[model samples]
Target: MTRSTDRWGVTGTVTATASATRAAAPDSATVAVTALGEAASAARARKRARNRAATVRTAIEATVEVGIETVDHRVTNSAVTFEPETDAAFRAVEEFHVRCEPDAVATVVVEATDGGGGVDHVQFALTDTARADLQAEAMTAAVDRARRKADRLAAADGLAVGAARSITTQPARPGNEPVDDAWESDPSVHPAPISVTERVEVEYELTAAETDMTVANDSGKG
Candidate 1:
């Protein structure tokens, strides 16, 4: 009959976080239109104001060259409201949300809305491709850090860290949230850095160290 020694192992659990950052540029802006008009008939006044607002929206769209520049735009709000004044007037207020790349184009979009509507919000953000790449980089760094910690811990206990048995990861979170960056007219100038952080918990297998193996052999001989 063959005798087998009981297997021994230790799980090293470690949590590590890593962050990656890139300069954020303006990726989107909001154009708000308030077209006001007064007519003898309420319906006519509302129609006229709404039509004017629609025209402004069309002009803004043309400036961006939607398909060519590959921009994402949508009408966020459109409503007609009346105010009590010397003469009843209807104001059609509409907001257009625009997002695109090569941030410099944002200036062109704002100019297009000029004389017709006002740009309400200009914001900075990371592109989808950039976000994905950074996330991968951060995750890799976190895993490496976890492995280093595991190795150190195992060394302390006269053990060798082996292959990872299991790994648990947390969703990546933005360290800094996107915000209005209208203060800087030039989107490329002194852009703020956006950081993404990722956390991971890893469990690694442990193997017997050389010293432990020597002691086991000595006991067997006795």
Candidate 2:
């Protein structure tokens, strides 16, 4: 009976040890939860670092601007013509055409007048080549003026004028385009001025030249 009692007591002790071991076992689920938390924390830190870097980059770049203006000169050349015609009633008509020959003339206009008698009037345009030559002359004059101006400016600044960088010319507007019916009915406006204008834009560079100078002293008293 003592042996049996001892055996039963030993068995009961073993069972209790097993139960304690089961209770102390770690939960795999809890391990996964701790790992997830660590991963989330690392991701948040990376995102914050990226955002800060972007902000720094944005603050590094900005800018300002400036502007400049220049002007050019032009000239206008013109000619006038008139005609008188006497018929049933002092009626006269004047007409003109653009001439390009003997001179470069544009905007030839025509007008009619009641001269109180019957009179016939006729007007012709100058040669086209002549008008074109005139226009060329006008452009030449403008270029000369521009060169002179550049020379003067350079002289004032103690610099030498260099070669022209660029040059451009534009045609002038015709005068006929400006006349209306109001001017057509009045004889006072009979000989409308025909004009052609030319514009020139020029650019020149400036340079400096070296020169030698000497000093001399003169004293009569000495």
Best by TM-score: 1
Q: Write the per-residue lDDT of candidate 2 for residues 41-121, one digit (tens) a residue.
A: 334433443343233222221111111111211111111123412112121121111111211111111111111111122
Q: TM-scores for all candidates?
A: 0.63, 0.32
lDDT of each: 0.53, 0.30
* Tens digit per residue, CA lDDT, model 1, 139-184: 7788888888877776776677678767777664654433444534
TM-score of 2: 0.32
Model 2's alpha-carbon lDDT is 0.30
What is the alpha-carbon lDDT for the whole of candidate 1?
A: 0.53
Model 1 spans with C-alpha error above 4 angstroms: 1-49, 67-88, 171-190, 210-222
Instruction: Point out the worst 10-residue segment of candidate 2 by lDDT.
Output: 13-22
